[model samples]
Target: MTRVVFLLVPQVHLLDLAGPAQVFSTAADLGLDYRTEYVADREDVPTAQGLPLRAGTEWPDLESGDLVLVPGWRSPKTAGGPRLTDAQVAQVQAHHARGGTVGSVCSGAFALGQAGLLDGRRCTTHHSLQDELARRFPAATVERDRLFTTDGRVVTSAGIASGIDLALHLVAVRHGPAAAAQIAREMVVYARRGGDAAQDSAMLRHRSHLSDAVHRVQDLIDVRFAEPLRLADLASAAGVSERTLTRRFTESTGLTPLRYQSVLRLERAEHLIAQGSPVESAARAVGFGDARMLRRLRSARFQS
Candidate 1:
């Protein structure tokens, strides 16, 4: 089981905390073996929105597989969110020292910077705080206009609702795209928003439609895109005639079922190739019989 611990700060933005918590909790509910925990420096914490919350003062046992996230809080200038205590900073640093992932959203990046985890790493936070974060942490390379960024084990997100995207990205990494999609579906979020320019894949795109039949077929195809699948098989899975499936699928996603699968394969192949895999190996890994078809698809993808 993976433990997802949220380190809550005073004046925390509710959505920054709730969004990711809901994601991991929903994943747990879906039998994903995820355990969510909340820890705070004090027993009672006040939020920027004026609501009060109670959290555990005692921390839990965590390993490398576990993740610790510091949700963003109101900026220090406005209400002066308290900084992480020295001991708490030590704990956060120690977790990373032990090879565990430590993440943040918005102003929470300041806490991570206090822990010295942002040194020489590319990270981001809420746009409003980007200049201050960069000024405060001169050693850190703070990026702008990113939903989230991962450099080694330290990750950071832009802010607010983007936390959901960050949590979904983490789920997809530990599990798979299909698992993330299911959790998003259960949460009633469109599957995802692209993390960045190059990171856009079929898994994140082509999920804006509300058709139950198309979504069901997409769920199946997402999990088995690397396999040899037939039109009859896909139509049968959707419980629709081949012709009707074709029409609806096209109307919903603007791609035929087979074409959707090909897009998936092409995207995955591109990722593998970018990671230094040979053309032939990447092609075969994403379900193509040979590099010839993958090359043709690559040419077509770039041209169109």
Candidate 2:
């Protein structure tokens, strides 16, 4: 079993710890070989959420394939948050030196920086701290807008909920996209966000609209984006005329039905290609009749 050790700093944000913990725990429930433990320099640490969490004071004996994650704590702007000891910092550095992967969520990047892991590496933290991180670690490359960044064996995430995304990404890397998708579906997450800094999945990006008609149409397209879909059928399911559905969907999501489906297809094709599928195979797998159109679309999208 792969061991995932979480270093719980004082005044840690609950969601920063809970989100990724839940992902791994759920993966284990699905029969993945994962074991989780919580460790801290002190036996009991107070959280920013007004609860005290108990943890082991001793670090576990970790080996290759083990992961150590530092969850974010209360902002340094506020007083009385936890600080890592010299011993704990050394432990993190030693783990990375021994080929173990190290990760951080939000301000946990500060701890990793203190461990000297951030030097000469590309990483990220919560957007609010990006400037401070860059200033503190002059040699580190801090990406300000990314949800996360992984350089070598180190991974760091932007903020609280992004931890779940980071963890799911690790699951995909370790297992496969299918496994990550299964875990995401079981978690009721609509779709996994890609690592791209500027864009999120269409379902998430367009979900803020309050139109029932548009939402119904989106639900249909999201599930069967790889299949041929008729606008009239989508309109009927949404209890609207085709023209009305078109107008409302465009108003809400800024994309027509066909365009929305194309985006999903392109996203899937990119994933397949990243997994080593040939362009032709990925194109066919995502419902393109041939690679020519896929190539054209990809070039057009990238250029624009």
Candidate 3:
């Protein structure tokens, strides 16, 4: 079983703690060997949102396959005292030294820094804390405006809801994209929200709009993106004329239907290629006739 340990702190954000917990818990429900455990400095822990929690003072046995995540807590802007004791910080250090993965959410990055884990790692936290994190940990690379970042096994998120994204990413890395995708769908989260630094994929990027017709069309396209889709069929699915569909899709997503499809195809093809698929093979897998189109799309993407 893969053990996921939450190193809970006083005043931990409920969502930051719960989001990742839910992901792994649901994964366990889906038959994955995930055993989630919570540990704290004390038996009773108070949250920033006034929710009280209970945890064990003693930590569990860990292996290299396990993960230790420190969820963020509330802190003052001014120089406040250290949140974690030196002993707790040493535990985090030892965990990484033993080759186990470690991570943080929001102000939790501060604890990792106190442990010296953030040194030379690419990490992130809540946007408001970016400057302070960088100011304190001059050795760490604080990624600004990022949803999440992974420098080797030391993953981090911007906190709160972004914690869910980081958890999904970890699931995807160890398990597979299919596992993460399944979990995201079950949780109603948009999967593959672009790169680590961006919001998400084209589907997620365009999903913020609340147009029912556009969403229906997008749903159909998401399912059959690897097929030869015609405008008429998309319009039929959206219950609109081809012209109207084109306008709505563009206005909602900032891309025409065909452009959106091309973006999706390119995104999928890139993943396949990253997994060592040949360019031609990846192109064909995403419904392209050949590598020529894929290459052009890639070139245009890079050039612009």
Candidate 4:
């Protein structure tokens, strides 16, 4: 059995808390022995919408679980409440040390960050707070655009509705892809977007800092993913050795030039597929050349 604790604070986002609760409750309906209880520092927690949630468990009486989700808090600029006090911090830290999976939605990342759980971890928060979060926590690698990021057992998601996406992803990880797909279908939400998709978007956003030559090469590749890319020509156009371009591109983006380009093509192909294009035509349009090859790749990477 997996027990999930929802740590509620003053002015929590009601929907953010409910989204995961719904997903896990569905898991229970499917005959999984999962339990969820609302816990708080006090017996009463208020929602940002001015609704009140009645906490069923007291903080010290709460037991560690297989997972815990903290919904976003009201912005510091907007709400007044206790910062995660010393006891709350120690409780969450102890849960992590016991190999429990923990995560947050939106500003709940602040609670996790404050507890020292996000140090040296990659995390994303609501975009509005990205700068302040980065400045406040130098050890965390703040990702600006992802809806969610999961490094090992600690996961974090971006603003408001993205909490649903993160919850679905956790379902995929905890149960299985088939189970997650079924849940998404039942919930009328899109299937979980793979982590690779999130990484590619983040990498491309950071690519502008590369040399002018690199940007030029990337631009050509972006506009012509269906065409053959020549490493020598790309290097020549950038006025750098192939090795130099590769190293710098990888360092800046965390992906080699070729892998990044392939991801771009795949992303386009996926869009085409979603628009009802025939698989073979979409593959050819993306430089994959064969529908079978694309199928194999999708199965290997995303099990679609």
Candidate 5:
């Protein structure tokens, strides 16, 4: 089993801790081999919400494939927000040194910085603290207005709800996009938004609608994006006419069905190209007959 240990700081923001915890918890409920726990420097920690939280004072033994997360706390500008002690910071560093993944949410990036994990690596924090984080840690590359950033084994997320997206991204990395989508659906999240350009999977990016018909159609397309699809079949699956499906899918996702498939194919082709596959081979693998149309679509997508 993979252990997901959260380090609780005094005056911790509830959502910053709970959001990601819920993601992993839900994954466990869905039969993923994840074990979640909470730890802190002290046994009783006060929360920003005026509640007291109990946690383990001792650190658990962690190995490779385990995760250590630091959730954001009350701002430095506020009273009662505790900073990580030198000992706590060392714990985070040691976990990463042992090949465990470390992550932070919002202002929790400060803890990671103190541990030297953010040095010379790309990361992010809440928008309100972006400038201050940069000023405090000059060597860390702070990205503004991102949902999250993954630099090697260190992951950082923006304020509040973006933690859910970050955790879902971790799930997608470990399991698959299909598993992440199922978790989002069970949690009633509309869609997973991207960070810093189109870093989210196509299933996530195109899943912001409330229509069950559209969601069913998107589910099919998500798994079979590389295969040829017919409008009549898609419409039939959604129990709608072809024209209605086109209009509704456009209104909900801002893309026609064929256009959505093309975007997925384009994204896969780009990934293949990045992995050292030839353009022609990548195009053929994604169901395109040749590289000509793929090149044209890539240029048009990038230019537009």
Candidate 6:
């Protein structure tokens, strides 16, 4: 069995703890080898929602897993009494040093950051802490809009409900698509989102940039997913080479320019389709020049 530890902190968000636990439990019921336990620096930590959760194991023996999950606290922006200390930090770092994967939910990225496990890695946290997380961990790529991010041994996620999505994705990664789908069906959530989907929804945004040129290009793309967007036009307006634009675009947003634009188009098209627009019209509205191509794309995306 794969041992998964939930590292609880004071004033933890109940949903953050429950979301991933449910996913793992569902996976086990569907025949994946998994076991879950709670661990913490203290034995009784009061939660933000007015209850106390026990710290199941001592800190020394907490390293029991192929995985360690740090669920977010309710108000991570504020310093609270049950906050993880430097000692707990060291324990997690040591576990990852031995090749165990560390997973985090919402503001749980802060714990991982404290542990130095997130240094020089791609990660994310709840949108509320994007600036603070980036400021605290200069070496890490802090993504605000991504559903979740996994870089090597560390995985981080966006706010609240996204924890379940990240857990289901790990199920897909560790077990297989069939297993993940089964778990998602049981949970009544969508199956795991593709990496590109995660990037498009949460990681890429109009406001998260340092360069005016990149911002201009991204803003234009955000508004005009229905228009024909050309690399040359974007690069010309931004006053950079296509290669430089591509590199900067990916560096800032973690997505290639073309793929980023495609996501915007697809998402817009999906909204229209869901609203009962004719598929052909929706495709054209989203810059797909051919109705036949839209049909093919729609067919690939959804069976119905």
Estimate the Cα RMSD of every predicted model relative to the unseen true structure: 9.3, 4.8, 5.5, 10.3, 8.0, 11.3
**lDDT for each residue of candidate 2 in 1-304, tens digit (9 for 90 to 100):** 8899999888899999999998999999999999999999889989989999999989989997999999999885456335689889988988999999999999999899888899999999887788888988899999877888899899999978899889999999999989998898889886577555432455677789999888888899889988899988999999999999999999998988899899888878887887689999999999999999899989998999
Question: In candidate 6, which residue pairs get closer than 3 Å at backbone N, Cα or C atoms, i.e. clash?
Answer: 145-202, 145-203, 146-202, 146-203
Taking all chains together, the TM-score of candidate 5 against the true structure is 0.66
What are the runs in model 2 whose C-alpha is more than 4 Å off? 1-4, 11-36, 46-52, 60-67, 73-87, 90-101, 114-116, 126-138, 144-148, 158-199
Give the lowest summed-lDDT range of ten residues in model 3.
191-200
Q: lDDT values of the candidates?
A: 0.89, 0.89, 0.87, 0.78, 0.89, 0.79
Model 1 misplaced regions, further than 4 Å: 197-304
Q: Residue-wise lDDT of candidate 5 within 1-304, one digit each (tens)?
A: 9999999999899999999999999999999999999999899989999989999988989998999999999895555246788889888988899899999999999888888889999999988888888988899999887889999899999968899989999999999988998999989997666556343467788897898989989989988988999999999999999999999999999999999999889988987886579999999999998999999998997899
Best by TM-score: 2
Off by over 4 Å in 4: 59-65, 78-82, 196-304
The C-alpha stretches of model 6 lying farther than 4 A from their native spots are 59-65, 80-82, 195-304
Worst 10 residues of 6 by lDDT: 194-203
Q: Write the per-residue lDDT of candidate 6 for residues 1-304, one digit (tens) a residue.
A: 7888889987889999999999999888877888888898778977879978887657444343478999998756666223567777877888898888998998889888888888899988877788888988899988666889889879988857888888888888888778888888999984466433444452255457787777878877887767777898889878999888988888877777777777777777776776578888888888988678667765776875
TM-score of each: 0.65, 0.71, 0.67, 0.65, 0.66, 0.66
The sequence of per-residue lDDT tens digits that candidate 1 reaches over residues 182-270 is: 99999999547656633234776899989999999999999999999889888999999999999999999999999999999998888
Look at candidate 4 and tell me the lDDT of residue 174. Answer: 77
User: In candidate 2, how many Å is residue 70 off?
Assistant: 0.5
| lDDT by residue (tens digit), candidate 4, 77-181 | 455333677877887888888887889988888888889989999998887878878877899998877889998679998857788778778887778777877
